[model samples]
Target chain A: MLRSLLEFSGINPLRLRMSWVSASEGKKFADVITEITKELQEIGPQQSYIREAV
Target chain B: MNVQKLKEEAARALGRKDVKYLIGYKKGSYGFRVSPAFIEPKEDIDQLIMSPLCNMSLVKYVMMEETLPGLTEQALKPSKIAIVARGCDSRAINLLIEEKGVPRDRLYIIGVSCQGVIDQRKIEARFPQVTEPAEVTEENGNYIITVQGQSHTVPKEELLAELCTVCRYPTPLIYDKLIGDKLAARPFHYDEIAAFEALPLEERLAYWQQQFSKCVRCYACRNVCPRWYSTICSLDSLSPQWLRRSADTSENFMFQIIRTFHLAGRCIGCGECERVCPMNLPLMKLNRKLEKDAKELFNYESGKDPKAKSLLTTFHTEDPQGFIL
Candidate 1:
């Protein structure tokens, strides 16, 4: 729902990625973060939704 | 349609030993304005009026009455509060009762089968510069609006509130006594949201950016929400200051996102927030988006059952987890 909202508001929904990580799953958290970072790098900076930039 | 029956019912409710007061709509001071009238005595029941213009939800006043101080321990006994409820207002009351926000035993809901209320702003814009008090009567799909000695007949659709346009429940879901003929529920449609969703992500963002930028941070949307009746909203708390007082687009976006998320699966599509917003923000779009998602994802429709637990409050082992990484 948050992703849909962000997408509707013109934000890159990929900028936000939710992963279920239990306290004991430190390796899983690291892997999730690394994957998100790679995706962000592929997507690059967010486009300006602010009117001034447009 | 029958003001006499409404008055009699209100008078009867007020006459009850347990009922403290009856909260309903009365005529406003000027054109197209209807104020919530509190009727204490049975004689004062004449002050109450029911019409398409009585769009403001009375459920908020019931919540406000609960939070007011100075009630003695003896006075705190579950006293009944009689409210004139439209379909949406009744739903709000049911949702409140379901969430334990208000006790059902202490409420006397006089439900009115609504034929949609007129949007006050739309009427004012159509008949501008009318200083005198106006009267609007719904007759056969037309609104006979009389202002400053001039009468204009306008199609109901032209001035009907947006919420009413797609209202699935026109009759109260739960009521002690219903007044007037019950209206059949309208078929729900999401074509508007679907069309918006069909647009490219950037375009959708740009559209919302313009709307969010117009926000002055008045918090009228939050104030008018029936579900957002928290005594101390986290957004307004000074200790944490979850939201700053800034009117910048980013801050406004954050505020809106938080507010909408909090209302997810709880909002009954009352559209009061969108109706009361000063910026004329398309808040219903955001709310309805969540509503649609909740329906599709969980088969949940809010405010329908008083006994059922809220969507976010309950979890199922068989719940869909495809969205989770």
Candidate 2:
């Protein structure tokens, strides 16, 4: 719902991602983080939505 | 449509031992203004009034009522309060109960089926400053606006509020006592939002950036919302300062986004936030977009059932997770 709302507000919905992993699934969590990093790099720097150019 | 029934109901509610006061509309001192009347025991119900000019939602004032800690409905000094409710206002009460902001038994809802309301701004713009009290009556899709010795007829469609045009619920869903006929709900669509969505993302961003830049950060939108019942808002909190006091485009964007997200499934479309905003920001468009999304994605319509599970907190086993990384 938040994702959709952000998208509607003209913010890229891809910037917000939700992932669920069990306590023991450390590898799965790391992989998810790596995947998000690659996606974020492709999406470029968010300008209008964020506070500063991080 | 019966003013007498509304007065009788208000008098009855005020006569109750537990009810502190009945909040109804009364004639304003000047033109096109309708004030929220708080009727007490000694006060006559003749002061109570209702019209298409009564555009402000009394639900926000109800939520603003003092609710001290450990003050249960049964134990409080003013155990119950009554208010004149329209279709949207009734939904606001339901949303409050669903979030535990207020108890059900503590409110006496006198329901009135609304045939939409005239936007105060629209009327003001059309008939600028007449200083004197103006009378408006609805008849045959026309508003007979009487100012001074002159009378002018205006089409209701031109003066009707934007939120009212798409209102599905014309009758109160829950009411302790009803005062008018129950009207059937209207089917609504998001033609404007759909058209906006069809535009390129860059144009959409530019549109919003311009709107956000105009915001003065007055917090009128936050203060007027029926669902913004937080005692200490995150914007004011030091621990996790959501947005700065600055009124720049970025900060305004943050403030609005946070607020919009907070009201995801709870906003009942009273459109009070947009109504009260001094900047004339298109806040309802943002709100309605979320409403449309919530309906399409979760198959949820808020304020329909107070006892139903919340949309954001509850997850179905078969819930769609296409966005999960």
Candidate 3:
């Protein structure tokens, strides 16, 4: 279902990844998001669900 | 209708060499109340009876009973206890076995083809002061109740439990001995959930928020729910703290959300949580809505198959995903 959601958003499959987060792992979640954001930027702005700033 | 046949089957099961005590319903201390009966001997099976008043789901005993006191190491093997299960109770039993909470070999079920049980609240509202034990017998579409030597006949619809009124399965799904034939299936509908869905999002959120704000962190809902029985309740863990100890609104909302989501595709719509609620919150509404959504979106019904994986645990590649946003 998560993959389906990502696919529907027109996100590139190779750039996105999944990670598990425990309640005590705030830093881990933050770090994963940071890495994912950088990777997304490296992949450049592809035409996707988000058209503009909300 | 076949009360005697049920008792006989229970007796036969109890008399089996490998069988332990059979669990059924007995009279409660007050009116319209039923208590769990643990029948051991064949003679004791005579106490086993089924009626509209016998609404307590016997499936809970599968997971609720404490291990026998000071048993020898050899005696620690799982006991094969028999259960007399109604439609909803049978589903719960199957859920327990599916989740591996109870071993399949440890259960012997005498499935009763239920004609729907009565709601104690409705009965009490109609016939109060049944201080002594009462009898509920079915006769020609009506339940005849006798208390303190006075008899009253009420139409079944008037006292039918809220869950039973909307029940789809009147027959037990699994059993060792079938006591009676199945009833005609009712038209399955989720009108209550539809009504709730028709509400505006703000109103719906507000409605739940208001109800959840009243929660006292009593844990009665979790304690009474057959599915919520894990070695440790998710709410109790300190590392994650899914729910905080304080009874404030923010924590209460989180608690209710997590609890309800955990039961998303698993609740049998037993109405136990609603009945056990001291504050009379409509907990079943939230549960029934989830049950409805599961049916509509995933075409999934919990406890129908012992081998089937849970809805949330196994996701389909083509599952509806656009609604998540």
Q: What are the per-residue Cα lDDT tens digits for candidate 2 across B1-325?
A: 7888898888888888889888889999998998999887878789888888989899887777754567565666666889899999998888888888888987999999998998988999998987898888888999999998799999999999989999989899989998789899888688998888887777888999999999999999998898887888897887777677878899998889888888888788999999889989999898888888878778888887778766898988887787776
State how far residue B315 of model 2 sits from its true place (Å). 1.8
DockQ sort, best first: 2, 1, 3
lDDT of 1 at B191: 83
Per-residue CA lDDT of candidate 1, range B1-325, in tens?
7889999899888878888888899999887899999888645677789888887888988888787778775786548888999888888988999999988988999999998998878988998877777888999999998888888899999999988888888899889889989888787688898889889977887788788889898999988788887777878888887767878777788888988998889888888888888778999999998888888888888998888889989999887776677
Q: After superposition, how far is residue A3 of candidate 3 from its true place, in Å?
A: 16
State the lDDT at A7 in candidate 1: 77
DockQ of each: 0.50, 0.65, 0.05
True contacts kept of 1: 0.56
Relative to the true interface, what fraction of contacts does candidate 3 keep? Answer: 0.00
Please provide, for model 3 over B189-300, each residue's C-alpha lDDT reduced to its tens digit, 9 standing for 90 to 100.
Answer: 7887776666664466567667777999898888889887776777899988665687866677667667777787899888888888887888887787778778878999
Q: How many angstroms is the interface RMSD of candidate 2?
A: 1.7
Candidate topping lDDT: 2
**What share of the reference contacts is kept in model 2?**
0.71
lDDT of 1 at B125: 93
